[model samples]
Target: MASGLCENCSQLRELTAHLRKVCREFERKIRNVFREFSECNCVRITPERSFLRTTQELPSLRLLNDDETQLLSQESLQALNKLAVSENTGLQMSAAMHYLHLSHLLKSPLPDAFMEPVMALLLSTDLDVQKTISLALVNLLVKNNVCKELVIEMGMLVPILELFQSGDSAAQCHSCACVAMLASSESNKDAIVVDGIIPLLALAKSYDPRVQQNATWALLHLTQSDGSTRILCQAGAIPVLVLLLQSSDSEVQFCSCTALCNIAAIREHHPKLLSIGGHYLLKSLLTLMLSSVQKNSAQACRCLQTLSKNVLIQEQLMELDCVLPLKALLKTSAAVWTEPAVTLLSALSAHPPNNDFLVSEGLLDEVALLLHHHRSSSAIITHSCVIITNLCSSRMGQQAVMESLCLSGLLGALLSPGLSDETLLHVTSCLNHLTTWSEWPGHPLNLSAAITAEQVSGLVKMSGQIQNSLLSCNCAAIISKLEMTEEIIGLLRPHYITMSEYLLVFLKKKDVKFQHLGIVTIFNLKKDGDFSSLLADSELEVELRKVHAQTEETRRLLQMIQPLSPSSVNP
Candidate 1:
């Protein structure tokens, strides 16, 4: 046995081996097991063969079979690379085969000098050279990440992607594998999508199942790009991927589902998916969403969550009786699908038919149970609040929510410090809908009847906070959304001076919702007599006219203010 140099750094370092051979019961040949070694130390254990440029004959690299011997010095690799690209067909074939053989024996990547020759051989018109090199490339790419980066850094990606259109099954199969390996890196995804996506889509219909499988896997990684969905769909990805979602091969179907998961996760892409696969994609995702396999079901649930945000999607889901599965998933205690399922229901519950069906199915109790179990997850809490908010839009939904035990946690999240700003925004918005809401006399059962005047004062003060504008704006918007009942006005009376400033400052801003909220809230608060005279002040009059010019609601309010003259002239 010969001592070996470290294949990676090509350094002459010391590494101890505990080698033993044992014969199987019926075999004369013995098997040797190699245990993993820890670290390499520079103890000058052995001398390496130096690079030689002599005119002597090259060693017989063809007949070598010693798997444990390190035959690749930097010099031998350079010599083989030169011969691999030679114009003579016989020399090129032998050198390419020797390089492929060396890839199996050496545990390290081929040096930087091997990249150009290997790339040239890959793009060669010869079938044997292309086939052999593709295998060797896949092996190197799997064992060494240095090779993956080298493939991209050397500008070999555009040429390598060209292999997908080669019209050769062997070339296409190995090419798909190589592209998927390259795309597994986060940094490599965008570059691959830039040049490789069109040719990549065609392989999904390859006569070879292996080619179809690897191509879909490549798309799975490529679609991980944040902005890749539009380019992929416009390149005819939806039709091909949707067909693969129904593939006889489970792996192909899984990969296709995952790629679609990435695509559908972008809400804007749903319409394109709908336009192409429409009912087919919708039903396929629904079936996978309820799959017995955990991974398939989880991914499909995420896709359906974003797709459900579309109105047509929601209508289709309702006709499929999606509420029953959603109800079952919500009550499964804790599931990978629970949070997204809640979000999907939140979208569905916004529609009238879905809301009515959800009420009839008694899903409110399941939602309340989910809140009790997963209350610690801010996402789940936030989505649950959205569902409650959507459900409140209907009379039956409001009745169920008001009668259930979910209100305490829903309202308690308002003051809970652990809740995120997003959760707080949805929580407060949900509270507004659940409370004494009215546009023109809404149902008046106020769960927010529990909000005290002190809490109102704190919320009113929060509206003036400059930091967390989302929170401040929401705080003011909710107060404005509330129907200013006598008790509500009485709560505003104590904070009238501060409350007036909030309303006036809001009127000077551009958001029409805030402007409307300020006017509606002020209109009810002016019954306090002090606020009425404040409304008659000249400064208040100018702010009023500015508001009047911005929206029609302000015009109606101006007419009713006795001291302020109504004017429609543009301010």
Candidate 2:
């Protein structure tokens, strides 16, 4: 019995040893499967037995429960780290693609460890892999300034630009998009411009509009730098951007117009932009503004405003008949469109020639209506006031304003309580121009009917209420011209020097009639010592002698003169 029991114990021990060996072999097999699968190039693992095997199938794939998921969660980072550094090209490519996809899953930037491997993989020979990496880089860089700086710091600009220049459309699109994202950072702008990406961007703009849109947007971002405008212009960007303005796509048109608008902001580019058919750009913007898309119209108007800063361009815009379309835009019930529209008109009207054109187009009435309709919006009122002020500079403009019955609106704006000081100042100046028109020859407007005691009273109140010296001076000058009553004299007496300085400024203006009005207003003040001093300054006497010497007002000034008190005279 004892022998039989011992033999049973021995067999039990042998069974335990055999089970342990089988368990070790099974664990080793599963470990090899995972190792080989992670290193394999195939996107999906089919239970392959070897790390290098491209294709194979194995049975008994089990569904993963919570336990398996927990295990994967713990090992996923480690596995990715290993895959990133793997020597196999296939595995490295897979790692790059995975990291890009995983970038979406992670909330922050790819670990500092991962960036080097991924960026290094950018030179992958496979076009598909290259595109994938480019696309991945775009996702990483989008709205992520940290990643952008990293990419920029890693010297990715050349590869990205090469992709923009030579890659397929998809590659170029993704690459250009990356460039756009990076270019948004103020820190990245110099790096981009220094690397000479402007020509590549200009080249990319000629591609499909999709690619063109991205590249154009990049160019737009570059222009934010103070110096990029010259860079882009030198790279032949003006014609390309101007041509893009004609695109039918609203977004394309909007982006293109904004880019051109930015470039045109640099005063030096004005002539270059114009010489490249900027007038057609104005026409296209006019056409685009007709679209229901407000942004398109707004951008177009802004571009026109910038380009119109050049007086020659303003005249060109006039010659292109931009007034009618701009007028139509003013008719829009939308104030969003009205501000830029009127603002552009204001810019165009800055040039005296365009002011006459605007008057001829009946823009005075439109501007008056704008003032009347948009009394609540200070921006509209301010721009409209600028138009009125600029318009009233010319005889044609002044007549148009009076004939269109905008005089009442101008007076009302001045009288209206709580108007912006800027608007009030402009309105008052416009009124002064209207009332003084009778003094200038070839001025046919009869402002006598427009002027009234109540209007003069309103001017008095504005002069006292506003603290601006120029505004008060303008009010006093208008009153002195229209109705030199005791109250007007009191207002003018204290502001004699202010008025003199005002007159001196306009006296220097190229407008002869403006100088005539100043001389007349000052002479009408009848401060004989002041009048004599004006005649005494040799330089002033020379300029006054040139043109104002013959006017009736000059004769009146000469008549009012008396010798200065020796005490008040400069030694």
The prediction achieving the highest lDDT against the true structure is 1
lDDT of each: 0.70, 0.68
Each prediction's TM-score versus the true structure: 0.60, 0.65
Worst 10 residues of 2 by lDDT: 55-64
- Decoy 1 TM-score against native: 0.60
* lDDT value for model 1: 0.70
Model 1 Cα lDDT, one tens digit per residue, 1-571: 6545457534323222211222232232311110111112231232211111110134535335444243455555666666566664545566667667766766765667767777777656677777777777887787782467778887767656777777888878888988999998877777887888888888887768899999999988877886666778878898899888777777787899888888887877877788864488888877776666656666677777877767878788888877766665676555566876887877777776677678778877777777767766788778788777777768777777766756666655565557676777777666665655432244344544656666676678778874666677777766665446677767877787787777777788787766777777777666667678767865656798877776677677887987733554433
Off by over 4 Å in 2: 1-78, 85-98, 101-111, 165-167, 194-199, 277-292, 393-396, 411-419, 435-463, 472-571
- C-alpha RMSD for every candidate: 11.5, 15.5
Q: Give the per-residue lDDT of model 2 (tens digit) for 1-571.
A: 4445577798998899999999999978986896676576673454222422321121111112223232224344444444445555665566565655554544554556556656666765556666777887777777362467778888878877777656488878878888889988888888888765655456445648778778878888888877776777787877777787777666777777888888877888877776745456667777877777878877788888877766766766777777776787898887888888888887877777666767888888888888777766777777877888788777567667766757766765665667777777777777776666655555445544455556656665555442475676677567556545455455445555544555565567675655655677656655545445644764555666665545667689887999688888966
Query: Which stretches of candidate 1 lie above 4 Å from their native place?
Result: 1-72, 82-111, 120-132, 139-144, 147-172, 182-199, 206-209, 221-235, 248-251, 261-272, 275-278, 331-336, 411-417, 432-571
